[model samples]
Target: MSSYTKLRVAIEKPFGKDLSSAIELADSILGNLNSKEVFLIDHYLHKPGVSQIVEFCRSNPLLYSSAGLIDHIEIISSESIDVRGRTDYYDQYGVIRDMIQNHLTEILTLLTLDLSNLTSPSNRPFDLNAAKFDILKSIYPPFLQSAVFGQYSGYQDDLESDKGGNAHVNISTTPTLAIVVLHLQSPVWFNIPVIMVSGKKLGKRETIAKVVFKKTRHVSLRKKNGYCDDIVFTIQDSNGSSFITLPSNHNFNLPNDKTWTYNEGDGTSCSSMKTIPLGRMALKETYASVLRSLIRGESDLFVPLSNVLESWRIWSSLLLEYEEGKGEHLMIYNKSFLDNLRLTLNGSTLTVFVNSSDPQDNLVSFEKDGISFKSGNKTVEKIKEKIFGHFLYKFSRSSLAREISQDILDTAITSVQARDSFHLALPGGSSPADVYQSLVVDYKHSFPWTHTSIWQTDERCVPITSRDSNLFQLSKTLLAQVGVPYVNIHPLFPVCHKSESVLNEYASINYFDYVLLGVGKDGHTASLFPDSVNSSFSPFDNNETVKFVKLPLDYPIKVKERVTLSMERLVKARRIGMIITGKDKCHLAHVIESKDKHNSSLPFVQLLRKAKPGTVKIWMDRNICKK
Candidate 1:
């Protein structure tokens, strides 16, 4: 090794889990490399077909022109099979980590690279790398609203079968399919859609990159032909690199080629056409080519560190939404959803409907960049009215408590009947204290106490024996009055085991059968405050279902430090019961329901959006709904 004059190392895909980790890894590797070039190996970049995209586009006038007028670009890499017995591995990585983050991203950079930045037409590694870095820097993060995630039907069944009846794995929410739209901030491709699609268990096994050009007035005579000028690059159907140009009335606009033939039909349509097959490049397998280049010190095919970090930044928000379980609606595959989605994106509009059994519930209408909820026959306001009217139960003080208690009992019985255990999460507040008392006085004997497990929604950092502790309040109100087993009570604080053990236990339990919550004047349901501690503890970013929160000293709460379940976990419940009691709470409820200025910051609104439509039960006094 000491004899070698120079050294170049090639690293594999998945440089890190996220932006922060990628930066850390990049710094560590560069620090020890002593100014040597590091090659990031993504086999897609080295594929002969994909590698030829840049040259092919630059040489052909039609392709080069289309690149300038690019309306949108679609990069697809899909498989026709499911996990294929890779349950453990696939469940963790999913399609986003496995495909889009590296393979498809690299292809995008290649297609959108500023060819003019290159000093020469030669395919020099250093020149290409520099050009790609420039484009990567100008790209903005993907818009979360424009992204759509999907999971094929029967995915859970397949996972359980693969793991030999691991029910925990059966509840996994990993997305096997995703369609993310990205845009470049640069003027060359500003606001142009760069759609990347990858998934498992699809219609067919194929990989292609398509460039859809904007309509031209020059082809007005070709109206009613339904013809489009699209250039498609593929490695699926050939032994080497090739691209197919869909012949249009403008085929003559392209350079002369022997393979292309055109015909006219009454000067109104394209009656006959021939696809122009671009020249092919016979090459070794993708990995073999990449390794050969790595050994030869060719850094052209390798992804640079700057590109890696920028890519993570583009996907950071989306990953956070996924962690919070509040991202795009994950539609099932093979249903009308994917089919309609394909047609919608390919057509002049971007309207797509979610896959649901009910026609009214399936309506999800929006344009490119966001999904908006629209009723099938009624307006959005009407729908909201129906939602709140059905879920919001107004009663007298005593009747509210009795109704809540009955709902809890009913949920417990149903859960115990189905799974032999009724997992319930209870919040601590003055509002729910009476409800807990009613549960003890009325249904304690008939409730499924033996099969019920009580979990604290939140607890103060103070000792369990302290009066401020939610556990102490529960003990005084319900635990002492009921015949529930001690082992069935799960407290957030004063645990005998490590915190990791607690998290693992919660994860194994998966979701609560019912969660009883109380809204604060600040619009916080659990211990989740309006302004949380920091990014590490942000409700939308943290992956932990249970998090330890240390509030600021200036916060208006008796307890500064607390432990609570995240909003992500609360939304997973089969039923969520929220109790609002006072005049201030009534005002806060209106503010939350109005979708006003504070809507985005309120945890209450987020829960409403993330929770299943019919699962939330609002138990409030008559005054709360008077306005």
Candidate 2:
């Protein structure tokens, strides 16, 4: 770029792997050249089908104006073939980086762009980037809870075969398929989930952007749980036809369906549009279109550096997480997984598809309620117990530490084996110090500290060196001796405001593998005091994963201010162990469980009610049972 004064250079896809790198790369280029001289290329934007998505809406403006009524949007890209030839490249950049970060994000900007401010597409370079930038700025980062990743059953074989026959390879966690849900912060599109799904192998080769409107009030449509007719932009079809699909009941619509397809045509009237014959569209050649735009200095189609950086910011944590071998478990899927998959989002409920590649056993689907299996395996059933319902284990004081430590180890090892990582959250205070000590003394050598991340469940707002600090106690008892990498230890910052970033970081963790909690005599867990309800310190009933609490000066606690995980967040763990040791605390736990409506306000009771049926396992000393 520095070589010429007024030359336009087309940078390729994937400007950088993450936000910092994107900024660095952009600065290096823009320092020598102005913004207009740089054209960031993403060929998907130039595809005639993708381009027409904007045109179709521009022609029919009601769809864009009624954006608030839309339920959700889905941008789907599926491939029938595996990444055999591109194995090397595919290994480095998984589905999210290869597709969702660039191609799908560009399509999203076009589909949801606010065109009301701009008069025409003719005003390209300035108008388009501004509109896209607005949408990008309004988007929240992708949350791990709303994502599902999968790899084909034989992906490892493909990787080895691509290398020499004798090549050694570790089991790869790289996902060939991923479905991630993104939310928009813009009031016009508030709270609507923009679902981006892309995957290779086991599905038809199809690329489409589907806009599903909210369910109508009409009795017939509501009875069928159907929403307003979906407007689908078919970027590529099995037969290579590209068209915008409109709802139609006529025989001429589709081969055996009811949808009128419109292809690219120069006409002010919608009737003038006609579908092109399959595999015969001049606009299908995206590379030619992009190159033509680059040479002609038409910067409208090119991605700007701002868009690249924003997209990177949205996906940077996920990319960094996986690169560090800390990501959601990559589900092994059979060849027919995608073919049998069905996704339905109705009202506030979404049903997700889950499939397993186990040859001897078959797992079906996962709904909001729980996982469904066609056949049962002993091991699978045991694991399911740890996730779905509540169980109580009463152990003597002697066995409490040993048993809980073993349980923690079991979960950590299982998580590492499945996802190459484990995330654990621990509560503070003197109650569970023995458990922490047992973990370090007995199982430190066997634990996968290298692939584990330790998070504080709650912390006193005092300095880290203070005696009241949770990190100080944790370090003294467990963390210092475990030999876990310093990078894996996540401490809640003493500065309450600084710890809010934990929510963003936690967004990339699917679930804490195991969370060790303690209930006080006041029926509070994780620094969530009973009397703090409705105060600024109340961490209940919010969407935040981490919260800051500041008690009044007269409060009895030594350190009045604190940072804690919300009850909503604590329930997201795969397993929750409540360790109640003292007689007074154990009595409070029983009273909380016994009193039905009267104890409803208690945080411990609230946790039991909010948690999945089998997820909360109470581990108590034998004294509770004896009493």
Candidate 3:
């Protein structure tokens, strides 16, 4: 910043940002070519945590030699970038040139470099540009094993380059997302594969590097509900470190089942390594140290041009191959890069938790796949809208849940503003539990609970204390966390298997304010199933809307039978929210008759047949939408 020229001038608001005080501060660091500073860095290197860890790695080489770095390294970072800030700069460079090319690459180098060979700025060799050359060398077969790129559905919708937007037209073809895997052939990283993942308009902000040691033998019990049990190993400069808390099995209580139980050779715990607490201040401190090196005329923190040029040369060739359709090895990202849906402590792990409080307003429109129908409440308007059916496809279930939580909040707010008590019908099953847990962590406080009432759309014919009960999940996820008075909760089928009694009881209510539903692998919603219509047992004949159809003794689900709200009443709610996740049930979605009254064997299809336009919505992840 010493020799950089500063432009001083004040202009109008918004459009004249070049004259702003922030712009002046940023400009002060530019135009310093004649300065004695041997290295220059963006603000990312100035984070306090980055500097601390890098400095630690530099000062203590013995620990790394003993414990050893992971053979495989993975860095994944993504954020939902807004259109207003870097709209113009992002168009041509996209995420690859803007983020992956620089910031991500820097983090990768900082993590893997052999610090013993590096020295202070004054004693560094003149050929510092060759520092990373060996690390970027191509292996025997090839260093880049695979690569991928993607563009979100509506990326170009807001672009009008003439007004500071990118010359964006078609979004499907452009690369707004990129993931690259490199097989390095260095002494420290021989046979090690490093993966870099980055993108724009993703689910949330995330950045982390994971190193994986190959073939380490350890026993692990598969975590329940498809969650992973992860373990981390730390090497420090003789200081203490604290490992993160691992998740426990929520449904079943067990004493001996620790999720992250691991072993260290020679019975030495790695807990005594010196470490800083993980958070923002540590990152800031690291960045400040990097800047200090440059201020003192050091090139130790700067990336060599040789390393950068090789990166560009390799990626450019890959881009050409991608354009010619020859890059089949490049895998497209079907899931959110920000989702840390894995369990491990080594180099391949990312930040393991989804930030529940991220705003859900990124709901832009994609290509229209709508189901046209005559809007009405008739029993057999012969409905079930198809094509898109107001479906929202997302890569992250946490994001899907985040978006849905807002809808729930909006529904409650409308009811409160109208001076009416909000009535909500909740569903059972694990599919909707992620959304429920997210609501508890991020959305519960904002809801108008005093004006809200909770009701189950369906439940098991057992005590509420049973693990199979839907009320058990609801109580654990939301009821225990929020102040939604106990009197406002309504449980169905709590004592016995009297389905008709609860059905008759619900008949007195006009309609539910909002409803949350989930689909089974069989494409069933609530207790409705394929081939469920009984000729001798019609709800209309019994004058009861709910029916308990006897299930075959050999049903796939362990539950003998499930009590559910009839499809007729389910569609009558003001908002019908259905969440579909995982790839297995995706086949069921394809099998569903999206056409009008083209009755299929699936109960979901039957329910859709009667669903009115704009009343129902199905939110699914990309994998579910993929063939």
TM-score for each prediction?
0.54, 0.58, 0.40
User: Which candidate number would show the highest TM-score if scored against the true structure?
Assistant: 2
Candidate 3 residue-wise lDDT, 1-627, digit = tens: 122223222111111111233234334533533223224354454443333445444444542452344445566666565443455656645555666655666665666666556564565453423545544443211111144456654555645543565464444354677666554434565435566777766666545455444444221211122212221212111222222212232122212222234222232333222223433434455556655655554444554334454545434434443454433222233235345223222332211212234323121111111111121222211112333354443433434665566567656756665656888889878888877775675445445677888888877766778888888988887788887889888777732355455556677667888889888888778877677533122353354546555467666766665566777788888887877787778676566524433557677666655777667677666456565
What local lDDT score does residue 347 receive in model 2, on the 0 to 100 scale? 36
lDDT of each: 0.67, 0.69, 0.52
> What's the alpha carbon RMSD for model 1?
19.4
* Tens digits of lDDT, candidate 2, 1-627: 011325888889778777888899999998988887888989887776787766665665555576666778888898888987678888878899899999998999899888675466464333777788888876655433346678888888999988875467877888988877676655466557687888888657778887776774211211122222566677887766777655432122232222444444334323323342223245447788888788777777888887788778678755654454333345777666655555556433344543324533444333222223343443332112231247655545665676677677657756875898889999789778989987775556556788989998998887788888899999999998987899898887633656345656765566898999988777788977676444466442333777778767776667877888888888989988887788666566456446353446667767877898888877777566455
Q: Candidate 1 lDDT, tens digit per residue, 1-627?
A: 011227777788788877888899999998887434677778777665676677665555344443457667778776777885787778777788888887887888888777565346566423676677677665545433456677888888888988897787636678888877665645466546677888788766657777767763121211255344666667454235454546554443333443563444455655654454554544455678777777777666777777788778666646655655433356566633333343245432354554445667645554431244555766442112323333665554545676677677757756775798999999876878988887775556556798989998988878889898898999999999998899999887842223666666666668899999998887777887776534224331323677767777777778887777888888899899888788777676566456462346677767777788878887667666465
Where is model 3 poorest over a 10-residue stretch in terms of lDDT? 364-373
Better of 1 and 3 by TM-score: 1
The lDDT, on a scale of 0 to 1, for candidate 1 is: 0.67
In the predicted model 2, the residue pairs found to clash are: 388-614, 389-613, 389-614, 389-615, 390-613, 390-614
Clashes (N, CA, C under 3 Å) per candidate:
0, 6, 28
